[model samples]
Target chain A: MSTPLLEAQGVRFSYDGRTPVLPGTDFALREGDFVGLIGPNGAGKSTLLHVLSGWLRPSAGKVRLAGRPLRDYTARDLALHIAVVLQREEHTFAFNVLDLVLMGRFAHGAGTLGFESEADRGIALEALAQVGLEGFENRRASELSGGEYQRLAIARALAQQSPILLLDEPTASLDLAHQRHLYSLLDRLNREEGRTILVVSHDINAAAAWCRELALLQCGEVVRRGGPRELLRPEVLEEAYGVPVAVGELEGGQPLVAVRR
Target chain B: MSSPTPDRSQARRTALWWALLAVAWLLVLGLAPLAGAAEISLPRALGFGVPEGEFNPDAQILFHSRLPRVLFALVAGGLLALSGAVYQAILRNDLADPYVLGVSGGAGFGALLVLTLAPAAVVAFLLPAAAFAIAAAAVLLIYGMSRWRGPHTPPATFLLAGITLNLLFGAGILLTQYLSDPYQTFRMIRWLMGGVDVGSYRVVAFVAGVGGAASLVIVWRARHLDLLSLGEQTAHHLGVPVASTRRLALFGASLVAAVVVAYAGPIGFVGLIVPHLLRLVVGPDNRVLLVACLLGGGVFLALCDTLARTVLAPTELPVGVVTAFTGAPFFLWLLFRKV
Candidate 1:
């Protein structure tokens, strides 16, 4: 009955105004919910995440956080609420891990003079530990392996200490083991820390196995919202992906998906 | 979470390295003036126990000639390096310098225009102000050119725009030189070759006040700049007011570079190499790099200026040549090392 932590009401968006990417899709993330938004390429999953993160404006309708329109919040105010893990993270410079993660404390009024406080360092270290990067404070960010860099991104988000997290294809470049490990980290953050999460992923099996709920997006519209068992049906996925799809059940009761080709 | 004692210790060690650089900077400032063509005894230069009349030419050689030139180089070089750190952060390219971006050329063009037309009485007063105006406008021009792609323009786009402006500005400078008569053309060439013949402390104070204050503005927002260097989207998510901070830092950095160009002509490469070299010593955190570049660059240019005068006795090379010798190769390595 409580107001959703993040809500999109008929949100429509487009990089170009003439063509809408999110054609009035609707979605919501309640507190403590771990939700995956899975769709084919160009389905507007990342675009919708951008809309929700307030990085992009919706062409129509509105996104609300804590029952208020998202546009009402300043960047700092929005940052105080939602931490984001953007897609295609790049570290071209050699900023050490600790300094990079301490950037998360910026919105918290800690890095005003560029010197973070002891408390800020403590929190950044804790966030690193949460992502299993406990001893990576001095390592160069640009040199990290794919898995460590991905987790470093999460550590930066966690250092924000926000109640809601929005990640866009965090595991796109990750190996299978690292993907599952990142998902487990997300799961712990959701169940134990009581944070709300919405992730956009192309990997359906990974999403189905890890996310507590799944939303299926097709042609810029979120058309199905349910347990993975319901939405992973051959017909639903076949329509979304524009291919014949096969579905099975895992021994753990998670859905298994394969393209008919 | 484990304690980050090592990080804290490393932070302390980095502070020490910067501190050592500061000491070295002071030493360079003190010793550079003594190395010029005409030697002035230290006691006489300091006017120790000497009457005012006795201090005329000897003390003038030190206090009026060499010391002013050295201080001018220090302030100008410091501002250039400070702005270079800022441009690298905002432009997101370590190879990007105000000189390469035509910021200095634009400022120099504005000063050239004033020197050509302005009354000799007020040229000093009008120079840096005009320079800052044109330099800031040049930055706007680059930002506008890059914005056609999007709000988040790729680094290459702006760099391309800037390099184009630098080329065009170079043409403008050449045309200005061609129009002036022989005496005026020679004077223009002297300034163009980058003279630090600052005769008074007032000019040094003026450059430091304007440029040093602008450097402070960028240094104060160093964290915001570091986040921005991570990428605008990432910085925005981390709570940086991306647009406003970028604007202010750009203004501050350009102003600092403008002050330097207004006072000292096209002294190239101090800005380009100082920050790049110091980034190796301390990491790319602008909080440290910005300040380090300030001191490190002042020392670098002062030493180079000293060598300019002393390297070939009785015949001084232009300071720009010395800097180019060191910086051009380093810049080439940065550009082609991975190739």
Candidate 2:
């Protein structure tokens, strides 16, 4: 098999020294893959994402991106290759929508601090339009709705123009319709643009409907990893989640999951 | 790599800001000397058709006395406001200033120590040097304390250390004032009030030389400060070299504050007021705001110093006193105003 675009080898992490958050976790993502990471709380999903994104270092192992050790790349070089959408962001300076999005071009620009090029601004505008925020250029971030802000963040990451995108609970604050739009957007980005995406989400049905691959995490380990058809069976999910879950099919044969009450 | 051409509108916006700042500088530098306690003829101060070697008191007052004092206020105000803006951005605290970090307190203590203990003749030289050294030491102490535990010095840690240092240094200044004799106590009071009284062109030169170098370093990091203000982790995610930028910013702010304080006493509120007010007017893009702080801050102090001398002619109020009067109301308004 070709080398995985992003691979974590026996990665282990902890907030404090004594307890392990990711105890010898291993994971990998291939090029052009749209994968969903689903796990209950305290399952180390966010910790693994942090490790992969170079925000946190693994105590026992290392992550590699495109066959190079993650440690070998500087933060700027990493940002040029990977863009991330975090669960939370801060906007204390009242930067406008365009200004916030243009920051994605920070690594791309040659200016020392924040002088974005005309081309960079054009690209940022394009990204904002891509995320359906075309007219929000002048608005302050504080004025945006929660869903719009999430899309705004994605727009900013899109301006990074990176091949790999990682998101952690991107739809946590989003309403149902917004979540649906976000999932469809991700699916389109994955299918049409052939971007590699790994989203950590709690929406199992949404993941099963859109993601080509699903990984079930529990106790800092990927217990079941496969195509949705192979991994969405009732017994598989029941074991991974420690609860009985009903797995049914829609008219399109996509898996629909619900707690068996 | 070749530098990309800046966005057309952004470039235009920045240029407009620069032009406005230039106009402000010219107006302040021109009119401030005129409104002082002693008036001077503009033509004489401009040195138009005056005999080359003649000693004219009007010209002398303009060039040697009034202009130097005005210029000193400009540089000193610029440094305080610039340092405040840098502190506000880097520390992610709007209230953060050189005074908040105890830099001004250390400087006040240093000046009083020199006034009380140093020989009379050497005081002109000793006062500024001692203040600069001691103020710089206080900032270093705060900087070092914040980073002692880990690689990252969270803004909270930095502000906590600064607040603690402020308390310690404030007590030291009070003790010095208490120990001094009546004559020295009078001198100490003047230093504590923070004024624009210039002794020589040398002190102005000293402040401009050191403070100008520090200002360049701070302004150069303006872009990074924008990202860093978001949060360190996000800044790192966006590819800012967070540690180096923080280090350089702190160094620049501390040096600028110490030098200005040494030369002009611990002039308060210019740092707090100028940057905050400009941010409201121009938005908080540090590229524009930091530069604005330099020019606008100088103009502000010069005007306030003009008020100081003119408001109670012959009995000059301290420049700090004027700023405090202006800033306290602004601070209260900030607390009460609707967002």
Candidate 3:
């Protein structure tokens, strides 16, 4: 009923001329929706997310955010409204976590290339607190464990104060406990903070358990889009993945998935 | 798991260490002019009434010659160090320096060309401006070549282009050297040696003015420099205009390096060594690292110049030679330690 917070109207892209990565893809998101994008390798899930976040431009069609075309917003303007957490952390310099988090406010104000004001520092500390990193702000980022680094990145995104969050494989390298913690954090942001989140993941069970709606992509096309109950069925997943998978339920009534022998 | 809070007392202690280092640097720079070939009284040096004695040529020599040279070394050293720190942060490579990117070679070639072609042109102001223009052109050419395909010039590709340009310009310098007569050859050699005979007060003021202004601009952009330390993609996602910011940084650093190289004739190693050493002491926050580099470089070069004059007695070794001898070994140590 309400205008979608983000919309992709027939987006298409190709790295090389002949082979298309995303073929005429159309998608939209409403406010506070937790959407999971799951697909096999080469399904262009990451490309779709990149386009939505304005990191990539589509060969054809348009991507609009908050009813404005992506091109209408400067990179800084877009960044103020959307935050992307990439998969790998490859920083060459050693910066303390608090300084790194404070960088999220770079697009906000004016103080010598937009210095960190008191309000900016307050927001950074609050974001760190949200990600359970309140006291680790003085630690060097290079010294962080993989899970701690991921949390720090989420904290940075939170400091951006963006309404839209895009995460690429947030749990891929995380341990089990960290993975659960990350999922709960995402859920909290989406439900309580009213942030729209779109996650690209390979973990089907995590997707089925946490996402209200899931889109199954195969060969650069959405094969199925529905509630998790419908999309997690054995037949639909087997079609998308091209492998036999058993879909079952746990005692808490969440969907569980496993590869069939 | 609970995270450990940073101890306030420890942070205060770290600040105190920085303050002590700053004071030590100032002391070294202040006292260096006194240690030259001549012996001047502390009272005379401090402008106290001169001792009731014959006109001390020693004090005159110290005031007129060594003090200005020492001042040149201090300012140029700080400029080179700050430029190096900015370059390393912007390029996201520790080995990156304004000189290494062919700027020094281009500037040298430009100055030589001007000196050879227009022998009558005033050497004071025109020479340095010509050198800066040529060096900036070389940077723009490299940047253009790297970006012919797209807006983004990846760090690896830019570094490769810079290395190639450096070699090409270095060869050009050799050609210029070979084609010249004995008079030209002697002048070029002296220039290459990076001595501090800056001729007059006007030159010193010019260098200090430019270096001082550019350093302030860089310090103001310290926050952006921090964002840039994260790889370009991450910086972009965090709202940095990676391409434009990088270009601006290179341009600013080039201006600073060109000014110093023009005045001092391409002093070696102060840029590379000062930033590297400072980074080891104070982590990689550019805000702190840049300031430390300015202080450390000024002190280090001032001390080295003192040694250059006093160590060889009547015959002074070129400060550049001392810097290379000191810097090359430290660079080797860094590589091995990093490995």
Which candidate wins on DockQ? 1
* Predicted candidate 1 versus true structure: per-residue lDDT over A1-261, tens digit per residue: 888889999987778778888888888888888999988888888888888998888878989999999989988998999999987665656888998899899999986763777888899999988877888997888778877888888899999999999999889888887788889989988888899999998888899998989998888888898898887899988887789988999897889999875
Candidate 2 deviant stretches above 4 angstroms: A110-114, B1-6, B44-55
Q: Which stretches of candidate 1 lie over 4 Å from their true place?
A: B1-11, B115-130, B144-150, B332-339
1 versus 2: better DockQ goes to: 1
For B1-339, candidate 3 gives per-residue lDDT tens digits of: 434333344355457657876896778756887886666787765556766665766667766777788778777888899999998887788888768677888888888877777656576567777777777787888777877857666777777777887788788888988999889888888777887767566777888898889888888777678888887777778887777778778877878888888778778899988898888887776766777777788887888888898997878888999888889999989878952
Which interface RMSD values do the candidates have, in the order shown? 2.8, 6.4, 4.1
Q: For model 1, how does the per-residue alpha-carbon lDDT over B1-339 read when each residue is reduced to its tens digit? A: 344654467568668978998998888878888887887778777778688665366677877788888988887888888888888888888777766566867877777787788898998788767766777688888777666656666667777877888788778878888887787778777777776666789989998998888888788898888898888889889898887898788778877877678777778888888888888778787878888888888888888889888899679888888899988998788767872
* lDDT per model vs. reference: 0.83, 0.85, 0.81
DockQ of each: 0.56, 0.44, 0.45
Q: Compute each candidate's TM-score over C-alphas.
A: 0.93, 0.93, 0.90
Clashes, model 2: 0
Worst 10 residues of 1 chain B by lDDT: B1-10
lDDT by residue (tens digit), candidate 3, A1-261: 999899898999887758999899988888988999999999999999988888788989889988999979876888888898988767787777987887788777522342356677788889898877877987888889988898888888888988999999988878888788788989988889999999999998888788888998887888788878777988887887789989888987788889998
Q: In model 1, what is the error at residue A56, expressed in angstroms?
A: 1.2
As a TM-score, model 1 comes out at 0.93
